[model samples]
Target: AREAGAPAAELAEITEATAVALRIRRTLGQHRVREAQLTALFDTASDLAALRDLDAVLRAIVHRAKLLLGTDVTYLSLNDDAAGDTYMRVTDGSVAEAFQRVRLGMGEGLGGLVAQTARPYATGDYAADTRFHHTTTIDSAVLDEGLRAILGVPLRLGSRIIGVLYAADRAPREFTAGEVALLSSLADHAAIAIDGARLLEETRAALVDLNAASETIRTHSEAMRRAEEAHDQLTDLVLRGGGADDVAAALADILDGGILIHDADGAELARARTGPQPPPTPAVAASR
Candidate 1:
């Protein structure tokens, strides 16, 4: 204390200790704030997993990323390479047209790198980075595609990278370690929901094919049943003391009867006289 005439060295030591304490307090406060924010984000993303529609889920993902990261630009890219070429699907923020439908070879570009490596990447200035190509934006005529700082996280389902989720800021900004971790967690949930939606769509298509097959089988069974009935009726006629002449007479009468025979193809294949009057037109027989 001043009144106690403390040594200058001792005073300096006390000042240094106070400064360290203050720094620790500030750091601890920041940690608590980040923790709270991450908890809320995690809960929100967990709720979002209930969404089953792919487009709706993607929109929610971008919206949540914007909210959680406090960035104006958010984007998601899914790799659609049936032929081993990477293409961009969608983005939350404005992108240049040149980038649209542009395919990149695996590991040839930044997005490609994310897909190939299945890792997260960040850059302070995309234009300055030799690893990224800014000319693509220029070619696309997307003037609003300015990125001072960007974060790209690979979206993985199990060990495979399905796509990538990204956020960008026009003004340079530093993302906390916690924010990166939170984004990673969100990407995991997003991948699961996306994959589930894809599987559901596949299952629905399979069910449709199965239904068509079942209908075809039912139609064939009905045709067989009709043929069996006809055979039994024909046998009964022969057993009832009908000789060839009698059979011919009976067939001629039945043929003269005005009746229609239908086949599985919805065609009126044959006609007979089931009524008292015979058909004025001659009877015609058809085979399946």
Candidate 2:
């Protein structure tokens, strides 16, 4: 157009049109990315709603995080209140054994800081980052795993921080604000699923205990009822001037077993048997 001596106004209009076209293309690309993210999140919520196993839900969360951010690795750590620390619970795209088993004390590393403060933290170079309290154990594991850049967000349930969700890379790279928010959103879903599953298990155990207690109470009630009936029958027998043999017979019938009566002088007065009877020893005979 320039060589053909096109007017300056026409050239400017063409340049403006090209710029508009580029902007529209960029906007469409962004919309596509947002749509994909929304779809992934919707699927995550669906998975959580149909949750059956806690471990499977956790694994899915980590895997989704890794895919969403296109990172080298993603993992989750859960706080152990009794142990006073956070330990790795699940991982995706991770291979190092030391890294998989690493445990971090409160405020010890990026994950620890996120757990302790209940906030998100990211570092482009974890080794050189001085914003966190570094420990030999945590640093060594990170080094072994070859993770340089790391981002961590708290898994929060109300005001409590139950764990940390992390995305890490082997090479130094700065994480963007959008990425932080995305990971934080995922952490929120993960936290609710974890807490819900735990509560469900606790409820199931309580119901089992309640059933056992009810059964025990029912058995005890039956025993007491039988004892009361037996006592009333025996009392009526004695009141009616029933002889020792009659009393023994009544006891044998009520108890569905044998009965023996002896006087204080160790002499057998009467005996009844439902089946066989062994002769009483001299010690048993003198028991009266």
Candidate 3:
């Protein structure tokens, strides 16, 4: 319009109108992005609600984190009480083997600081950052992965910090506070899902143990009943003046095996056989 020699006042109005339109477009774009983020979060919550497998749930969480943050890598670390450290549990857009398998001691690195303090931390240049306690192992892995900017947030369940969720870039870039808060929110959801999955696993194992114990008890009870019934039958046979042969026959029927009796002089008195019978042993003679 200015090149075409439009009036100054008219040109000013046009420029102002163009500026207003640009602002509106920017605002709409931000709203759309926010809407998409909200949709993803809702989907994540639904996934957690119907969660069955912990690995699947964790993979989904890290994948969503990488997508939402638009970073080079996204990953999660889980605390190992027995190992006394946090180890990487899941990763998205990661190719380095060492980084995927990295373990961070408490207060050892950016992730360790986040896990230890239960707070969010970010560094635009991790290699140059002196705010965190860096270890050779962590530094070597980070260098190998070529991650320069890093952000980490605690995975908190109540006051306990179970792990850390992280986003990183291969180039130096500042992480905004909004990004920190967003990752933290995702971590909150991830924490709850992780805890729930663990509890469900424990419950399943306990149920299996309970069922095994119940089965054992039932088998023992059945054996006891059979033994008592056999004892009663033998007692009744003796009370009725049944002979030694009758007792031996009853023993064979109850035990489903051969039965033999001998007197104190080592002379055979009665025998009942389900199969061929063998001669009396020297132990029987010794007893006589």
lDDT of each: 0.72, 0.92, 0.91
User: RMSD of candidate 2 to the true fold?
Assistant: 2.8
Model 2, TM vs. native: 0.85
List pairs with backbone clashes in candidate 1.
75-92, 98-140, 256-273, 257-272, 257-273, 257-274, 258-273
Which residue pairs does candidate 2 place in steric collision? none
> For residues 1-288, what per-residue lDDT tens digits would candidate 2 score against the true structure?
988999999999999999999999999998898889878888887888688678888888999899899999999999999998999999998889999999999999999888889989999999999999999999999999999999999999999999999999999999999889889999999899989888888898899999999999999999999999989998998999989889889889988988987778767778788444566788876675
TM-scores for every candidate against the unseen true structure: 0.73, 0.85, 0.90
Ranking by lDDT: 2, 3, 1
User: Residue 13 error for model 2, in Å?
Assistant: 3.5
Candidate 2, residue 154: the lDDT equals 96
Compared to the true structure, candidate 3 yields what TM-score? Answer: 0.90
Better structure of 1 and 2 per TM-score = 2
Better of 1 and 3 by TM-score: 3
Ranking the candidates on TM-score from highest down gives: 3, 2, 1
Predict model 2's lDDT versus the native: 0.92
